[model samples]
Target: MNENDKQPDGSGGPGGNPWMKSLLVWVCILLGLALFVTVLGGPSATATGNTVPYSTFLDKVNEGTVKDVTISREQIAGTLSSGEKFRTVPIADPTLVPTLREKGVTIAAQPAEGGSIWVALLYQSLPLLLFLGIAFFVIRQMQKNSGSGAMGFGKSRAKMLTQKEGRVTFADVAGIDEAREELEEIVDFLKDPTKFARLGGKIPKGALLVGSPGTGKTLLARAIAGEAGVPFFTISGSDFVEMFVGVGASRVRDMFEQAKKSAPCIVFIDEIDAVGRHRGAGLGNGNDEREQTLNQLLVEMDGFDANEGIIIIAATNRPDVLDPALLRPGRFDRRVTVPLPDIEGRLKILEVHMKKVPVAPDVDARTIARGTPGMAGADLANLVNEAALMAARLGKRLVSMAQFELAKDRVIMGTEWKSLVMTDDEKRMTAYHEAGHAVVRVHTPASDPIHKATIIPRGGALGMVVSMPERDNYSYHRDKMFADLATVMGGRVAEELIFGHEKVSSGASGDIKQATKLARAMVTQWGMSEKLGMLMYEEQQGETFLGYSQTQRHNISNETALAIDSEIRALVDGGYDKAKQVLSDNIEHLHRVAKALLEFETLTGDEIKRLVAGEDIDRDAPGAAATTVPVSGTSIPKTRRPKGPFGSPAPQGA
Candidate 1:
């Protein structure tokens, strides 16, 4: 037997079936409910007044106090002159009725229609009718939801979208031209399947779209559907699996069967990793429904003949977890990758969004694209929306570069937190901290250009110094890494130099973490340490912290471990000293930038550059230092800054 074929936990071996426990519990509950309703129920409305002997009833009737009487087969009910109602057992005497008629009392004797027995029966049956009606309604709803009955869990739930359903064509998609071209071929085949079949070629049965989330997987599928102008069926991976076994398998069969009826159609399963994971790896003890569903999907995919005109496309971010059988040649003929857009691709995506909104003459989508790297199509769309919102809040006629800059900041960080009041000392410290980062970046030739600097408390940090490349950067040199480390450490060095080491705040905690991480990567991952040579001492997955190891067994000797630690400390210490020296020499320039920040509370990248260069601004001019307000962050904006060299404006303390 296969090693993985071992019985799952609680599969009813020697320990007994787990279902027996649940069945026993249900039985106990039913018994308790039955006892509660029968023994513990309260009194009824007809159970009032005490029973009297037939002789006493006859005496009361003779006294002429009895007003009316109702008689049944075995009982007699009557009302007195004082309007009190009473009931009593009837005696077996023919004289009873004649005696009542002889007196001035009115008497009634009837069948089931209006007798006391019939009234009691009607009241008793009403509650029963009400309970049965409710039960019937609940049962009908369950059948409607669960595929005709409890056993219909395997019914198909794929939604069919015609051309009018959010009709997205190839023109609506951007930032993935290569992927679009590949999908376009599929559309062509669908448009005219005979074109390829006549040449003795088979149409591709399936195309797999692999990418990170929000990178346009679903949009691409829709674009294909719109381009082909055929029925588009959409279903998620989770829709197939249910608590009952074989349901997912049934749904898979049903989904394909429905799609086949519409022959020239596209079936898209989004996030198929939910059901397509490797079989037999789950928390369940016995047969798993997900595996059954996956097996059914594989059979259906394989069952279809070539050029049958029913195409399947599945999307998943986790291609690693998918079973290899589903990815074989005949099943998935094409695999397309959709990654985050590069600079040019970002520009195209921005232009597409830009066309939908009103923009000023100064707005340049290409320039914005150059500033934004490592952003997906969805992220760009969100950026455009944020920019338009900012413009409208500012009451501007058109979307300006200024609004775009603020939107970018809001996206990268969080909404501005200007309402958080801070003391003068804290603000000064924040200014110096960011100035230190900016100064070190400017002096190091290998460092990225300083795009902006601010003392405003945005996101969780008290301040931030942003570094941007002229264009999208793919590779980094060793010297650049060293420079980056120095830049990260400079803030702490600045605080220690100015406020004394003991007075330095814990705000540098994040900075120390970043610097330590970079230094350790240099020694262990990058092989920059001469003592370590080109060999890797750590495990396959590197650590998140410097000098933190993940291996179960020690790969290196005790002496080598000590040496690795020594190298990491040496790298960080060396970078720290480099930063100190730069700050000491550029103390005057740092003060100028801080002074400007203290007065204006914020400065754009252009303004920072100008300030650092010792350029004099018209301090008294109209709107020379006007700050834009944060319109909707609960805190009214005291000032707004313009966009900087990076796609958005440089943020000061806005």
Candidate 2:
């Protein structure tokens, strides 16, 4: 019998004979009933007469009180003259037969029964049979769990996904149209290979999906399989590697063998970088087990034997670490980049997720998408789910726009720390700090437009000033970097101007840290400083291995490093001076905005502008009439700046 035919429960597997399983079950039940009858009936079978001592039996026999005697090997049974029966163990005597004859006692012999012998044999062997059966069962379970029944240690762990219901197709996927288009050709090839073959085009052997995490790479792979209506096999890269050497290679061979049986199938290996790292990149010839596995994978993918109908799709965020041989043309012919969604893609993703819930008419997908600039499809799904959760928590019938706004804030800015209490003086100081950021952003020509200012504690910040870009910007301009540096320094500048230099608090530490990082990036990485020229002063280092540097080749001299530091410091100082000037000139406007924040705890950009123009805001009314403040000194051009949700690290006071 094949090992695969045996099940863990000692029953038959799918391919096994059904009648055999039924016969085994019936045999076990009969054996149990027989054992139960034997145990319960054994003691009562000979429990009929009274047991007497040997002396009493002999005395009775000599007195002729015993009428008949039935003698066995161990004991004697007899009937007395009073018509009572008794049994006893007898002592051997040479004259016993003569005495019984003299007494005229009828003598009879009792022999062993054949049925008792068989019953004894069954009782003795029952425990042994039970033990053997249990051992067989446990071994079968172990084999089944090892993945291969007889070939235990070397079977592929890839799971075949038979999407009977809720199968994902291209229609279910959003926010990654380009990636979908790249894999669509493979689907078409799988469905009808002749269309491509007529044009002398071979189907791509493999396609590598490269993107950040949560960018829907794996989902796209599944969509391809669903579109073609073929078998899908999925596994992780880590599943191929094991502690024992050669096991991974064996598994790889076995995996391809299985895939061949189900031709025209899609095999997805998620996070392929785990086993596909560059060979000999680590210390002392690198990992032998992983390297061997990767070699086997490369061969099975595109080696001597042509795998005609199998399409391999792998997903990994760390494409830089993968081996080049595995990424060659014949192996992975196409590299699809699944990037973060743009505004329109985000809107589509939101709309897709929104369909799953009951949303009010006031909830706008475009507005939420605009607010979330760098979010991926997964993030947008979470955002919609969060809004629904918030609505449900409030016991509302439908998810409204207010719930979405709150959910967005919670996701971007961290949950509001409502339990954190602040004294009046601290609140006042935080209000002033955020007001400084708002004023600087409003007056700076190249800065992004301010979205909201709040004194409420969120995440690690005591207060935050959020800015939103008019549109997505890929590359950063020098003016925008300078504007960002100045904006970050505004909190410290405001504190010094309002509370005096000696009374400045440590709440500006976060702002100072943000400013330093921005300035250093501008000078060393972005090449924005004139003194540093347009050359990159800092080298991009390779990823670390085992807490040690993989490549530490610093070409710059000590003097050059010192010069770079000086340039970064100069940039930061220039930003501080610029912010000081801006805040000092708009001192009155700063106070007004701060007072409004203290009153409302949060204020929108238009409200801040209205406050600057000496207009009263009606808290109860929407779109209250307000006058626009004209720009006087700096020419505030409406240029776009790329800023993430809550401005990345955010312009905040710690």
lDDT values for all models: 0.75, 0.80
Cα lDDT of model 1 by residue, 64-123, tens digit: 888888786656788888988777888788888788888878988755433445455644
RMSD of each: 11.6, 6.4
Model 2: residues with Cα > 4 Å off, grouped in runs: 1-47, 83-85, 90-102, 113-130, 145-148, 152-157, 162-164, 242-250, 280-292, 395-397, 501-503, 541-553, 622-654
Candidate 1 runs further than 4 Å off: 1-89, 94-128, 146-152, 283-287, 304-307, 538-554, 618-654
- The C-alpha TM-scores of every prediction are 0.78, 0.84
Top lDDT hit: 2
Model 1 superposed RMSD (Cα): 11.6
